[model samples]
Target: MTEAIVIAAQAGRALAEAARRAGLRPYVADLFGDADTLALAEAYRPLSGRFGSGPAAEATLAAVDGLAAAAGSPVGVVLGSGFEDVPGLVARIAERHRLIGAAAGTVAALKDPHGFAALCGRLGIPHPSVATDAPTDPGRWLLKRVGGSGGNHIRPAPRGTAPQGYYYQARVPGRPHALNFLADGLRIEVLAVTEQWCAPTPMLPYRYAGAVVGGASEASSLPAATWTVISDFIERIVAATGLRGLGSADFLVDGSDWWLTEINPRPGATLDILDRRTTPLLAAHVAACLGCMPALGAQPADAAAAQICYADREHAPVPDLPWPDHVRDRPRPGSVVRRDAPLCTVLAEGADRQAALARLETRTARLLAVLAAKKTHPEEAP
Candidate 1:
């Protein structure tokens, strides 16, 4: 029997790819088991309709059990995007299998805005102000879903009673950057410093657009002293939280000060951008969880980028647009996707960050145009 790794997440395609790159077979269970992800997995299960009004943990556990039965005890379980809203469920899953990432306690603490803000204060890490209630000055604070992933639930605070799972964060100004790293529960190794941006729709003002790896010309124009401070800050966080596996720290770079934004304590979207064929990141994540640290090299100078393309209007993917080789997580034909739903993930590499990002945007535009045109002329779709 082939030894497989179990991957459960909102979207398992990227994590599955990471597992495959690491030379491990994956048994995947996720909300969207896209065609590509299904093809890549040794076995697959869909976690649809398991959790409606309740926490998703039940469905998540069921998925893991199903996958494990087929794969005969996976190496470990890697939880991706979807579990932020239910960290307790993550803890429950960990009890059954060796989780290849942060523990439930670490996740619970870091995900709580109020608790994390307090942690920042205790560690002397610079962080923006946070509150449970909506701020009187909506313009100065942003409302965020406490454990939301990908920037979908963040918006300018509105004047009203705060939502059940929402909190207010003082809006900080500067270029948004994300730091990807690997930790061994106590020590950390920084991987890549990336530029994060958003593509707003009618509903999502900060829909996660994409990220460019090696974005800064030399990993930020900030001086060595500033980077040293950031490094120390990350080390302190690792020491305090005992975070393990692959994770990324979101930050707002204001001049020389790097304001910590949020911590994604799981393998994130940046996995695609920073993936090196020779050094699959999932391997490092697995190693880290098992008390081993992989020697991660310094961030490369070459620029690579990944963008999530969303449907502008209700339209099906064009059947004959000669879909580029760089796209992943592609939707099935004639699926009748709704507006603002993610269509696919586009990737590009260039000599510099600007060039790579421009290429990705152009490619995204071309794909969207094709989808729109195909919708207008159904006969031309094929």
Candidate 2:
């Protein structure tokens, strides 16, 4: 069998590792080419582009074609983050290779602000009020790019001149929640519900921080009405979008009221929490994308949390330090890292969501301190 190809802005390390556990060699294309991901992938190519902006579609196509030729057959592609802005490019890629996720048309519908809102209205799914024009009160609304992912394109509205391809959404107060589900176009299977948080910095208030996955036991504590609302909304969305394969629905949950925020039509960051080696998620993602609805086995009992560690200030990358086993996504040495840019991802686990999140927070703080201290005394670092 030809190896699977995974592409994203930063090719997901979790996804690449899951592909390996699924017994398939993965050829990955992305911008970062992080150390761990490169080690796991059969071959790695760097994607040329910035996040939030559209992907480098031409470079991706060239890389995929080369990989397919080297493999002696056409390899299936599992697209990730950056394609959200380039549905046309996705369509072009699908025309040449087998795509293992939402088709181009589906992506267009989900990523289009007006189209998604209309779909939600048709299906009676509760969505926040959205408008094409900036609101009178900037504090009451947020400006969001139509195809932005990773919270990079969101900001308080009524600020300086808004960027192109932006729309305004009524700001709602609530904790962020994401529902990871697998679908076979018509049917939907709920995999896990994760609590997501933003690590605010001076430059970006909604910078994606991390997520705690699973936590069904913890979710049970919410009002019964909350589950009903979430379930009904998920069912309606699947029916309306005809989404297939690994996907997630982002929500802002304030008490029992839930507001649909965004639809992620590909494997998302929450994969770190839901991955089980017994039934690796990448294999399931591919299977679902190929028109099969794989069974969602029981979620793991222990919840997992993954946090993005950001650089506090402009710093020259330190030499090797005693990074903990849980650390991944480390920035390369001698690289100049800007403030608020992600330095690495730290992972931790506990029996429940709160426990996992707390541990992750503590671990993250310690890691940041270590990084800071190591910068001061590079000779002490290993």
Q: Highest lDDT, which number? A: 1
What are the C-alpha RMSDs, in order, of all predicted structures? 2.3, 2.3
* Candidate 2: tens digits of C-alpha lDDT, residues 239-293: 7777788889898888767789889999888777688636788888888878777
> Residue-wise lDDT of candidate 1 within 235-266, one digit each (tens)?
78888999999998888987876799888999
Model 1 misplacement above 4 A: 49-55, 215-222, 297-301, 316-322
Would you give me the overall lDDT of model 2?
0.77
| Model 2: CA > 4 A from native | 1-3, 51-55, 159-162, 214-221
User: What's the true lDDT of residue 55 in model 1?
Assistant: 47
**What's the TM-score of each model vs. the native?**
0.93, 0.93
Model 1, global lDDT: 0.82
**Candidate 1 weakest lDDT stretch, 10 residues:** 49-58
